[model samples]
Target chain A: MITITGLSKSFQTPYGKVDALKNINLEIKQGDIFGVIGFSGAGKSTLIRCLNRLEEPDSGIIRIGEHEITSLNKSQLREVRKRIGMIFQHFNLFDSKTVFGNVAFPLEVAGLSKRQIKNRVEQLLELVELTDKTNAYPAQLSGGQKQRVGIARALANNPEVLLSDEATSALDPKTTYAILELLRNINRKLNLTIVLITHEMDVLRRICNNVAVIEDGEITEMGPVQELFLNPRTDTTRLFVQSDQDLQLNNYSI
Target chain B: MADDLLPLLIVALSETVYMVLLSTIMALALGLPLGITLVVTSKGHISEFSGLNNVLGTVVNIFRSFPFIILIVVLLPLSRFLVGTTLGSTAAVVPLAIGSAPFLARIIENSLKEVDKGKIEAALAMGAKSITTIWKVLIPEALPSLVRGITLAVITITGFTATAGAIGAGGLGSLAIRFGYMRYRDDVLFATVIVLVIMVQLVQWGGNFIAHRLESKHHIGM
Candidate 1:
């Protein structure tokens, strides 16, 4: 479970101060698939990055379970991070590592025994259906396969929370669906809390049970996914739902 | 071409090899950490010590700006102080390594910069410490470029060894000056040049081969 309150971040550009994230408040329950939807420059990335304290907030209180994440020191933050796994839009697997090595990296950093690491990595590779590609480098894998490896690597430390930053945006439609399905399966199987952000409405609709619509660094709407889809409160959310409908009608016309 | 000259050529070539190889090893030892520090301490980087980064950067640049000939003169005291002499192939190693360490550092910094920032963030998110991220992700990702850059540095150091011969370092360049220029035997000069070219070529070839093999393994092409 994660709780965020009064978070604000700003960046100084040549022109002036740019408020990337306004005073924001959010909550994600355990075992819930939460999606944060926003267009480019809407501070979606900053919001998610702030959860892991990758992007230091100018002011905020972030609580993950009982620990106040915003107040943790360097070593304490690292300890907190062990419970939170993050994936990138680019599938940032270590290019120099084999699939097994990439998945096992977190375990090694956690100082697991060699035998434990081998067993855990093999189990992860099997879960991602990448057993055959265990020895392959990231460069050699397809985009879908690469994302699978990324997913496997994220799950290496048995994290309670997985933060996905546009994790499926780089893939094709079929691959996107497959990755979303994988995320859903992982959520159910491990009871993991997933907080994913994307600009695509389809990405939110496919898997997210609870969704927050963000615009210009503020949360415009937040509720159950189906309720928001049926009755969007803000123009941004309405446009997203309308567009999804337009896309469905266009497919029918074709 | 005579028997006496054959032995002389062999000794000079070996001396040159010794100077260049030792200096390169020394330079690498000093420069690798300097390079990593430059990148790590940079603004917005993992370490993010801009003050330290700027000061160290300026120092590396100052060392790099000096001409190798001037560097040799400037380092004369240090060379003597370090190795108990300032006039032989052994002593020349000090100036040569000091002269090229900054150059190697800059090349290494550039290669480290080429690694994707995403990789670093991913590492951090996975609870990896800064040193671990640098060693596991940053250095390994930049290794091929670093290898090629060091090859260039090695070749450049080889040239510097010959220049150092002007100061009694007893390499092929010294033999060229003593035998070819002083004694008017152009053959010795030509032979030295040919040998230097051959040595550089061999090093370049080897560097490229190793870099390609590493690139094939590590480059993600994404």
Candidate 2:
């Protein structure tokens, strides 16, 4: 389980200090696929990044499975980070590395023996179903394949929580559906808690059990995915639901 | 006359190769760490020590701005101190290396900076130490660019060797000036120029080959 309290972060731009995240609070239960939905600049990215302390919160207490993440020193933070895997929208698999190498990277960092790394990486490739593309570089793979590699790499450490920062935003709809299915399968198989942030309500509808609606820098609505989709409270949540429905209608017409 | 010129040309070509190779090694040795330091210390980087970044930047700029001809003259004493002489191909290496180190550092800095920020963040997210990220991620990703930059540095240093040769550093350049131009032997000068050009072309071709081989083949529509 992960708990965040009074989380706030701001950036100093030339224009002046701009608050990217307000005093936010959230609790993501274990084995739950929690999704945060917001438009661009809604601070969802900042909120997800802050969970890993990727963007350090100005003031907050973040506790992940008994570890007080906000209080840990640099080395301690790294140890904590190992248990919290994060994936990016761009599928940040190392371009210079083959799929095998990319998946083996975290194991190498964790100081696993070469034999252990090989076995584990092979297992991960099997999990991601990219066994045949093991020798191919990231550039050779399609977007879906690259994201699979990213997922495999993220899971290498057997992280308790997987953070997906708009992981499917770059994929086409079909690929997005496929990737979401993969994530849902991984969540069930590993019972790993997943915290994903996206602007797409279809993503929430597809995989997420719980959803939060963030507008500007604040959460305006929070509930189960179905409840929120059926009865959106705030204007931002309504806007997102309306748009998602419009997209579906347009797709059906096409 | 042809026999005499052949031996002289052979010796000169060997000298140029010796000086260029050694100095290039020296430049890489000194400049690579300096370049990494520059990038890692800059704003919002892994280390992000602005003070060190500013000081190092100023120092590199100071060295980079010096005219190569004057730089050699200025470093004559240091070269003599380090190599026990300021003449010949071996002694020329000290000044040559110093002259090119800052230039290579800038090239390396640019190459390293071009590495995707997202990649570094991914490495960090995976619990990689900064050193690990630098060695395993940044270096590997930027390798092709780094090779190209080093090739440019080598080619630039090769040109500087001619200027160094004018000051008693024995090489094709010195031979061209001393035995070829001074003696009005257009044939010797022409031969040296041809050798120099071929050497440069070979370096360029080799650099490109290695870089191309190292590059990951990207499929269309990425």
Candidate 3:
């Protein structure tokens, strides 16, 4: 569960100031598969980074299950990070590490013993169905396999909230569907709260329970995924849902 | 003529080999980190310490811009402190390492900068520290470039070592200077130049082969 109030971020450039995010407020409930959809530079990435305090907001109150993570110092924030995992679009497995090592790095950082870490990494690999590829380097894996390793590594600490920043954008459609399915299974199995950041509405339709539309650093629409489709308010949301020409012509139902 | 020339040539060859080998090792050991540091301390890279980058770049350029002949003179004291004398095979390596480390660093930094930032961002997203991302994603992905950078630096250092021999450091260059430049022995000079050229060619060929091996591995993986 996470809550944000009056968040704004402005960056200084040589010419003038640039506003990346402007006055955003939202609340994410426990066990919710929330998708934030926006075009490039809609500030979706920055917004999600703020949730885990990876990127600091100039003014905002971020409450991660009542801890107010925005106020924590570096060590305290790092502790909080252990409970909130993140995956990337490029499946950022450590190129230098074996798949097993990549998945176990978090466990190692958490100071687990060799036995405990091996056991946990093995369990994680099994969850992502990457057991056979344990010794393979990230460079050796296909795009889909790389993503599986990323997911396994994210789940290493048994994080309650998993943030996915365009995690499937770089993959093929088949791989995308499989990764989404994996996320759904993880959500059901662990009751984990997942926050997916993407620019694709099709992705929201596939896995998100709750969907939010962001435009020019503002949240224009947000509600139950099914409901948002039926009562799409913004031009952005309509374009997102009806992205396929045939879908727009057919008038999609919830 | 053959018997008289054999021992001297053999000794000269040994001296040249020692100079090249020691200087290359020193250059690699000291240069790789300097390059990594240049990348890390750059804006928006691993460490993102721009002030450090500026200071380091300035220092590197200052040393690099000075002529090699000047560098040997300037570093004479440092060479003595390091090797207790600045006129032998061992003594010359100090100048070679110091002179080329920064040049190699620049090459390394440029090479590392060519690695995909997308990969690095992904590592960071997974909660990796700055060091992990650097050593893991950045360095490995940049390996091919690093090999090329190292090759360039090594060749550059070889040239510097030969130039350093003018200050009395022993190598084929020193032998050539002694017999050919000072004593006016055209035969010794001709042979020395030919050997140095061949040695450089071999190094270049070896470096290119290794760089290709690394590049192909990366290509196959991707």
Candidate 4:
């Protein structure tokens, strides 16, 4: 459902030019939960941002469904963006808007009538189990509930692809598990193509079927999650798998 | 003499209100868009146009740095051209609005800047156009602060109105100078000062009330 070829991005810092993503290529199948795992500064964030053209790549080709996202003009890209929903680590909700207002934002942008927007927003809220909090503002909700609003808002347009940018990073482990479960349920229910990036091995293990290890702007390992977990190839992948095991051991000891 | 004082004070107070209120409306009309433009066109913003941003910034700065008294003199012809005379409270509004507009713009820019960048990115990611984001996200999020800033602008313009009275614009300031200083009627000056204080207090109180109400609704989430 999504394909990228020779993607590259660099930032000109005061010190010098630093490569954020260097010649990255990947493919994600429809209805698959694809995960990119990397440490901070490993460029995973940049990689996912490029998928939606939120962060413009210095050079690359990004294809989502039939649209070549990188080649689209401003207006064309905006039209295509309606089909690609993105959620952030911070939830990025509008503080001024209530849950219903937040979820209805995309519908409003899509130019739906007031009745259609209310109906669609209600449906989306039910999907994310936030129906009870419709009129509540984001600050009034807990972290998990806010994330639920984010999920509902992301799904408002019935997007074909859902991009999660460390969406659960800010939550506690218990909350993270529940949010991931929600994402899994969403993926299954909608058959949506999911692309997520994270620094946590547990996050990938919990939901991602296919995982890629990124290091210093390059993908060092890519394969099925189980295969990579059982027989890791690179030092970074091995460290990640080892850490996941260590976490399990600590849980057992506790 | 004492019987005539009440009517004269009433007229002067009304003129002060007229000049302040009209100029404020004009300032808002001119300044809001200028402020939005300053924010939207800056480097790395939604529609990043650094050249236009710098030029506009410089113009706003230049206008802002001019003293109000100098601004009145400098804008004399504009006031005359705009209102057909440069001596009355109506003519004074031309310089007053022009003087306050850039100051209000800076305040508005600061308030808008206080909105979270992440919220803007979220708006863009959802396929919202720049105009939609500005109207829906930036302006709404900064509304409370904008109110507070406008309160300050209105108070500043009120002070300018008094100064405008010095030159012949009929208001409390001219009333004080003409009667209290020239005619040696300290009672007239005292009355004018009291009225001006009451007006400013009402403006501040009203601004705070509205801003607090908005903040309760919008900022509780932050």
Candidate 5:
């Protein structure tokens, strides 16, 4: 379980200090797929980044299980980071390394021996269904394939929590669905807690058990996915629900 | 006559080879870490050690701006101290290395800086420390650029070595300068230029081939 309280993040701009997240309080149950939805610069990314301490909060407490995030030192942060794996919008696979090597990287950093790394990499590659592309570089893979590799890499070290920052934003709609299916499968199979941030509500609709709407760095609404969709409190939430409503209403041809 | 010319050309080529290889090795040894330092100390890098970055930046600029010939002469005392002599090919190795080291450092710094910040962030988010991130991610990601930079440095140092030859360092450059320029032997100068061009082409071609081969081309579905 993850609990975040009074989470706020601000970055200095030429104009002044710009707030990315403000007083973001949330609780994600174990094995829950929680989604943070927002428009551009809405603090969705920042709020999610706080989960892994990727973007440090100005003031707040983030607890993953019993451990508090703000209290971790450099070494302690790494320990926390290892448990909270993340995937990116661009997939961010290492270009120089093969798919297998990319997956093995975290294991190697954790001081796993060559044999251990090899076996783990093999298992990861098989899981991602990229066993054949184990020797291929990131450039050789398609967009969907790249995200799969990202998933395999994220799953390395058996992280209990996975933070996906717009993991499907770079892909086409079709590819996005495929990747989402893969993520859902991983979550179900591994019972991993997932905190996904995206501007697209469909991403949340697809796999998230719980959803949160963020605006100007604060959580404006939060609840179960279907519940939030049925009753949206904020204008942003209304917009998302309305869009999905339009799509659904259009399809029914009533 | 052709036989005599072959022996001389071959021996001269050998010296050019020696100087380029020797100085390039030294450049890499000193420059790679210096380059890594420049990246880490920059504004957005892991450490962002502004003060240390400034010191490194100033040191790099100082060496970079120093004219190699004058720097050679200025370094004469130090060279004399290190090698017990400050004249000839061996002495020339010292300055040649020093001259090229900064060039390489700057090149490496530029290459490493271009390694997408996201990759480094991804590694860091994985609980890897700065050193581990560098080893497992930064260095590997910048491998192609680093290789290209080293190749350019090698070729540039080849030119620098020829100039240093004027110092009696004794190489094809020295030979070209002594017999070709100073002695007014146009044949030897023409020959040196031709050899240098061929050597550069070879290095450029080889470096490019390796960089391309090292790159991962995106084929998403495959």
Candidate 6:
């Protein structure tokens, strides 16, 4: 479980002070696939990045289970980060490394023996169904394969929380669903808590048990996907839901 | 004539190789850490020590601004102090290394800057420390470009060694200017130019090969 209270962050831009995130409060229960949906610049990225202290919050109390993440010093924060895996929209896999090597990186960082790293990486590859691509460089993999590598690498440390920063945004609709299904499967199998930020409503409707609608650094609506989709209170949520349907409708013959 | 020129050519070529190699080693030893520190300390970087970054930048700029020929002359006193006498290829190494270090630092800095920011972030997010990120991520990622930069530095230093030889530093450059040009031996001048060109070609070819190998390994996948 992760809880954030009074979280706020602002950046000093050339124009003026831009508040990237307002006084945000939220809770993500363990094993729940929680989605934070918003348009570009809606603070979805900032909010999730803040959860990992990748983008530090100006003032907040972020408790990931028992650890007060925001208050932890440099080394402690690193220790906490090992338990919280984060993936990016770009699938930020190390270019220099093979699929197996990328998966083994976190294990190496944790000071695991070579034997242990090999075993763990093998298991992760098997889990992600990329065991055959163990020797292949990231360049050799397709978009879907790359994301699977990203997912395998993320789970290397046995992290309790997985933060997805628009992980499927770069993929095609088919690839996007495949990745989302993978995420859903991982969440169920490992019972790992996932906090994913996306502008796509299909992402939310497909896997997210609960949803939060963010607009200009504030959460305008929050609830289960069924409730939010059945009745969206805010125009932002309505727009996102409508756009996702329009996209899907376009793909269909009817 | 060929027999007489052969031994002199051999000696001068050895001296040129010796001067360039020693000074390049020195330059790399000094410049690599300085360059890494410069990048890591700059604004929005991993270390983020802007004051140190600016100060180092100014220092590197101050050294890099001086032309190699002028720098060799100006650094004579320091070279004399360090290497005991400033007359030969050995003494020439000091000024050459000093002149090249700053330039190499800038080259290395640029190469490091080209490393994907996402790789560094990924390393950091994986609980790797800043120093680890530099060694394990930044350096390896920038390696091919850095190798190319070293090749450029070596070629530059080879050219500079010729200038050093003009100051009585025994090498092909001195042989060219003295027994070749001054003595009106056009054959010696032609031979030395050919050797220098060949040396440059070899360095460039080797550097490109290594850089290409590294590039193929990653193929800019990130």
Candidate 3: true contacts recovered, fraction: 0.25
* Candidate 1 off by > 4 Å: B220-222
lDDT tens digits, residue span B140-194, model 2: 9899999999999999999999989999999999999997889998889999999
User: Tens-digit lDDT track for model 4 on B101-155?
Assistant: 9999999999998888889999999999999999998998899999999999999
CA lDDT of each prediction against the hidden true structure:
0.92, 0.92, 0.83, 0.93, 0.86, 0.90
Model 4 alpha-carbon drift over 4 Å, by segment: none
Off by over 4 Å in 2: B216-222
lDDT, candidate 6, A1-254, per-residue tens: 89999999999999999998898999999999999999899999999989878787999899998999999999999898888888889988887788888888888888999999999999999998988899999988999999999899889999999999999999998999999999999999999999999988888889999998998999899999999888989998888878877888888956
The residue-by-residue lDDT of candidate 1 on B76-99, one tens digit each, is: 999889999999999999999999
Residue B125's lDDT within candidate 1 is 91
Candidate 3 on A1-254: residue-level lDDT in tens? 78889999877889898887898999999999999999998989989888886677899888878688879976677677877888888776666568888888788767789999999998999999989988887778889998999899889899889999999999988999999999999999999999999987778889999988999889999899888888889898878777744564666653
Reference-based TM-score of each model = 0.98, 0.98, 0.90, 0.98, 0.95, 0.97
Better of 2 and 5 by DockQ: 2
lDDT (Cα, tens digit) per residue for candidate 4, span A1-254: 89999999999999999999999999999999999999999999999999988899999899999999999999998898888999999999998888898998888898999999999988998988888889988888999999999998988898999999999999999999999999999999999999999999999999999998999999999989999899999999999899989989999999
True contacts kept of each: 0.75, 0.62, 0.25, 0.64, 0.75, 0.61
- Model 3 residue A206 distance off true place after TM-score fit, in angstroms: 1.3
User: DockQ numbers for every candidate?
Assistant: 0.67, 0.61, 0.37, 0.63, 0.57, 0.59
Q: What local lDDT does model 4 show for residue A224?
A: 96
Candidate 6 or 4, higher DockQ: 4
- The candidate, 2 or 6, that scores higher on lDDT is 2
Encode model 5's per-residue lDDT on B1-222: one tens digit a residue.
324445666777887788788878888899988889999889878878899889988888999899889989988987798778987766777888888888899999999999899999899988989998888789988888888999889889988888887886777888788778887877777877888789999999999988776663432334
Q: What digit string (tens of lDDT, one per residue) describes model 6 on residues B101-178?
A: 999999999999998787788778888889878987789878889999999999999999998899878899999999
Sorted on DockQ, best first, the list reads 1, 4, 2, 6, 5, 3
Candidate 4 pairs with clashing backbones: none
Give the runs in model 6 whose Cα sits over 4 Å from its true position: B220-222
